[model samples]
Target: MRGFTVIWLGQLVSMLGTGMTNFALSFYIFEQTGQASALTIAIFCFVAPSIILSPLAGALVDRWNRKVVIIMTDLAAGIVTLVWLTIVLTNGNLEMWQIYLGNIITGAFNAMQFPAFSAAVSLMIPKEQFARAAGMLDFAGAASNILAPAFAGALLGTFGLVPIMLVDVITFLFAILAVLVVHMPQPAAEMIPEGNKRPSLREDSLFGFKYIRERPSLLGLQFVFTALNFISAFGAIIATPMILARTGNSAASLATVQSIAAFGGVAGGLIMSTWGGPKRKVQGVLLGMSAENLLGPIVIGLAKAVPGWAAGSFMSQLFIPIINGSNQAIWQSKVPPAIQGRVFATRRMIAQISFPVAVLIAGPLADKVFEPAMSSDGWAAAIFGPIVGTGAGAGMSLMILLSGIVGVVIGLVGYSIPALRDVEDIMPDFDALTAPIVNNEPAIQSQGE
Candidate 1:
């Protein structure tokens, strides 16, 4: 099979496996002990390790053989998941730290897999097709997300997490096999000198950062969305749950909403596959932001008041693949193959920082401010009394509106920023993809820092 074809298949299978693991694990931990903090710790364990190691992972990816990196990570992940599956099968005693440890290790492996995959994409796919490929990848992920919860429930109730984990293990094994079968050429001579003693893995990883330094625009482009990511986290996770609680939405309804949202991703991906995204893919990003700005928060806010939550989640989700697909195309076209792994890895690392912080603040805000503000005759009643309104879950509604306002303002700011809003004009190179060398070998150093 062609490298891209193999990769696309691997991604689809792996995403489904991952989605199942996520659903099963979250449900398992929550059902075991309803403490919110347990879940929080689990999340922190999973995410924090990855965050801490991203810089190192990117650098290593640039220096290492991309295919080898991918295979190794998959192999390790499969082994680890297998072990976890056995623990689940035995119905042995489980501990919080054990779950955390498992989460942290898996997350680290996942982080390593990203750079390798992104860099590989740069080597394998037609530049113009980047968006379409991304759309497909996004769609697969979204579809998997939709199926995971229901699948997890079935597996858990019948055979439990062990059986589900066995499936995950098999998925990882297949993913590794896919990578093993593909051929990936190496970096350019220009990027890695002909005879200079090969640098240590750490030094190679840092090359990604250096590459970014050479191109300031790429660095800046990554930064433009930092604020948006930070704020969106709060609205996406915290706000929805709080508002839903206020509404008559049941647990199953919330899960249904979550599952339905994936269809939007499917639509976006299918559309991009056919449309190949906009002429200037950056416009897709901007458009996505604009849509998220206006639609997402409004849906979350009114979910309680209107029946929109019944369908809004799906509607909003539809935009995700559209935006994600466009972003992938833009990156693929601009970044050189050699450096793509490191650069994309570094990019992901920086972008993800907002999530933890956002979650931290979000938990408190929903608990303290948003929830109480609109409560019957609460704080807002005394001040913005007329603004929020009387009764009828005004606070949650107000929070949603404010979230939308924040998203819109952020989009406007992005529009104003010359480098970000007008990235296509400045980085016009994305419009053109020239085959630079024989064998489609990687030509750029990976980005890491």
Candidate 2:
């Protein structure tokens, strides 16, 4: 716990720095282009490469030292930030291409960093404390979200983007230093039977998919989250545009709404860390999703003012920590530490695969389809105009509304599935496996039966 605590603190600072930079960059881009497509494209560049390469990176993380993986990836990301700073200092201007390139490079590194950090945490913490530990991690992210926008907003007005980038580079250095001083345990080497060869890298990479496919409960949970991610991306991607459009492109209003929404995440994380979650962790996940969808986008779509948007945003983020923390605890307990990196990576890739696709389409959907339809004289005006009103952001609002409704349905449908509902009970904890470390693979009964 002590080692985990130190790492958590350092990562917290790093996240804050990164968040500040992201906020500043997003604002700058949006203010310049005033286009949702540009922002979505930038986000796509950052996410697509990571999702595509997660399996290979996961395999490498399992084979390499976890601490080293974390250190190197963090260092790489820091160097990328430094390069951007240098370009900004020298050139006195940044092009969209530079931002896209940097995002691509750092995204590749994150594919390795995430799984390694998750696997390392599993080794460091006790099984019973998994949920609490996950809560703390979420808390770190939530705290960053809460602080970044406010700090970035003030600094961007006073000092500019250079200072924010410098802070990000410094925080990355602090994170690397923290990792340098900590001791991380490695998974024991697998023992091969006489005349039997070890698994190849391809086999190792594919193992995570194979393992999940054989477990009905785990597979069910993955499908639910995959759908959730896909549906949620539509609304999430368009949120900034919706707010800006409604507020006549007011940056202060956008910042206020974002900060308030992040406060909800911070509060949720604090509660989860202290009280843990429901006894049935799946309940926490499903119920949280339902509550969030009902309270968040639905309300936002109905509102035309900053207060309403802020309220909706707050509710939208409040349950995120509970959903994520509970879900993470389940995975950490069910999967043995030895293969967690690959399994978690595969899990992440599958769960988030829809996100990039949704992001890619969200901009077009909002800008082309929905917005025009919801216009005063557009086709959709007769049907949805009375509810959401006919205007510039009305079509995007309709899309957000539909997304929330579908998200609620997804949660409700997940609850109806017995496998996902009883995943914790259906699958034994890693410690309870008969041969938990057989050939560096978990030896558990396949729930496919």
Candidate 3:
């Protein structure tokens, strides 16, 4: 417990530093290029690699000492951060491709870090504390969300991105030190004769998919997320930027708006920490998704349509992650421990495949189809006039509206699917929330040999 506590604290600091660096980097790109396209590319690079390299990373995580994996990732990440800063300082100008490369490399290393950490947590923490611990972990991110933007703004106004990058490097070093101090006791099963063991990598990576294949319900649940991410793309990436451009807010103000949204996430995290989740984790997930999905576009679109961009963004930020965390809690408990590295990674790969694609198409889609129609005196005002509005942000608002409707429809249809609905009943006993309802029997107790 002491070891875990120490590691968690250090990682919290690292998370904050990571958040600050991201904030600084996004604004730096904006300041240099004055184009939203560059910023979108940076975001794309950061996320796309996880989908690309996850299978290999997952395989390796199951085969390695998990603690060593965490430490190595921290050390490598720190070195990369330091080198990037040094290069920027040595050179008078930074190129767009250089930043793009940095982001892609960062994403690649991050791909290794997450699976190892998650699988390690599953090994280290007892089931009773799993949801509670997850809540606190999310809270750390929420806190970072609240502060990182402001911290980056301060650093930018004072010394700049290079200094903030240094701070990130230092935080990584500190986090690595924490990992060094903690001893991750090996799982008892790992001590058994090597020949009798499952093929660690192959078995781990394929297990989650196999589980989903057999259950169908869990697969359906995850499939719903895939649908949601693609549908929401129209609003999240496209409409918000257009709205801000129309309103004449600077890059800094937009960052501030995002920070306000983090405040919402913090509140939601705190609430989940105490409540755990609803009696039925799946029902809570569905309910939360339904509620937040509608609110997101409304908040995002109406802000552009009216004068409430800040307020709208804030509300969406607050609720969306809470729903997401609830979904994560469900998966964490439901999936078996040995296969989590591969299974969860595979699930992540599938769910996020659409994100980069959606991001790629979002801007263009807005420019070619949605934006033109919603412009003043465009077909939007002439035809679909009432719901779309008649102002600067009309097109963007309409897009948000459309995405929201799609998220809701997908969620409802997902709820109706018996396979997804009954995954709670059919899958092995995991969480009490869905366990008894599914099996009509007692729960499985963990009895290590």
Candidate 4:
């Protein structure tokens, strides 16, 4: 508990630093290039490499000592930040290409850190506390979301990017120090699934996919997330535009809506931390998703004012942490600690696959198809125009409303599926496998005497 607590606090601080750097770098690139494309490319560089490398990273996480992996990732991330600071100082400015490269390098290392950290948490904390731990993690993310943009914006105006990067480096040092001081527990002998037969790296890497393929319940759970991410992408892609259009393009209005929504997330995380979620994690997940799916879009779609949108958005955002916290708890309890690295990585890869595709299609869907149809004199204008209004963001609002309905349908359909609804029952808890670790000694050992 102490080890997990120390590591969690360190990582929370690290996340804030990372968030500041992310905002500052994106701000710098956007300001320099004066082009949204350059900013998007910078973001893609950060994300794509991590997605591409996750399977291999997960495999390596399983093969190596997780504590060492955590320590090395912190060191590597710190070195990356330090190098960027050096470049900015030496050159007097960072080029767009250099920023892209730095993001890719740091992102690749981060791909390894997340799975290793999650797997380690399962070993460090009691099984009953998994939801509470997940809630705390979500709280950090929400807090970072609330603070980072404002912090970076203020600092950038006063001090600029170098100081922000320096702050990030210091936070990484704290992270490294935290891991160094704590002894991470390992899987007991009985918990190792594959006996002593070591395979090639490629085989090990693909094992996560194969493992999930055999488990219908886990696969069903992932499918639910796939649908949710895909549908949610519509709202994410158009949230700002819709707000701006509806509010006569007021940036302050959009900011206000965002701040309120972020506050909702913080509140939700706090609630989950206190409640520890439902006994049936799946039930909690379903309830949260149902509320989000039903309330988020409907309220925002119908709103003509910022307060309506903000209220709707707040209600919607409130469920996210509960949904995620409960879902994380289910995974932590159901999956064996030794193999969580590979399994959770596969989960990440699969769940995220649909969102990018959705993002790519959302713009065209809103502009060419939806916006035109909902024009003042167009076909859908006659039918839905009166409800959602006509022109500008009307079609996008309609799209949001439809997307919410789709999410609700997905949640209902997912719950109707026996394997998914009964996932907790179908997948037995793995806590017993981890109960015998006498201390935090390394549990890398052969099976069956």
Query: Judged by TM-score, which candidate is best?
Result: 2
Local accuracy of candidate 2 as per-residue lDDT tens digits, 1-449: 99999999999999999998998888878787888888999999989988889999988998889999999999999998999999989997678999999999999999998899999999898977888888888888888988888988889877878999999999999999999999998876643333455668998899789889988899889888999999999988898888887778776888899889988888888888887888899998987888889999888888778888889888887788899889998999999887898999999998999999999999998888999898899999999998888887888888888999999999999998888889989999987876644445544432210
Checking candidate 2 for backbone clashes, the offending pairs are none
Model 4 scores worst on lDDT over the 10 consecutive residues at: 434-443
Stretches of model 3 off by over 4 angstroms after superposition:
190-207, 305-307, 381-394, 430-449
lDDT of 1 by residue, 55-118 (tens): 7887777767888988888887777778777775676645767788887887787788877777
- Per-residue CA lDDT of model 3 for 281-326, tens digit only, reads 6765676666776676666665543336656666666665556656
After superposition, the stretches of candidate 4 with alpha carbons farther than 4 Å from their true spots are 24-42, 75-99, 156-163, 189-196, 240-255, 301-306, 363-399, 432-449
TM-score of 4: 0.83
Error of 2 at 320 (Å): 0.6
After TM-score superposition, what is the CA distance of residue 262 in candidate 2 from its true location, in Å? Answer: 1.1
TM-scores, all models, native as reference: 0.84, 0.95, 0.86, 0.83
lDDT of 1 at 333: 73
TM-score of 1: 0.84
Every candidate's lDDT: 0.67, 0.87, 0.70, 0.78
- How many backbone clashes can be found in candidate 4? 0
Q: Candidate 1 deviates by what RMSD? A: 4.7
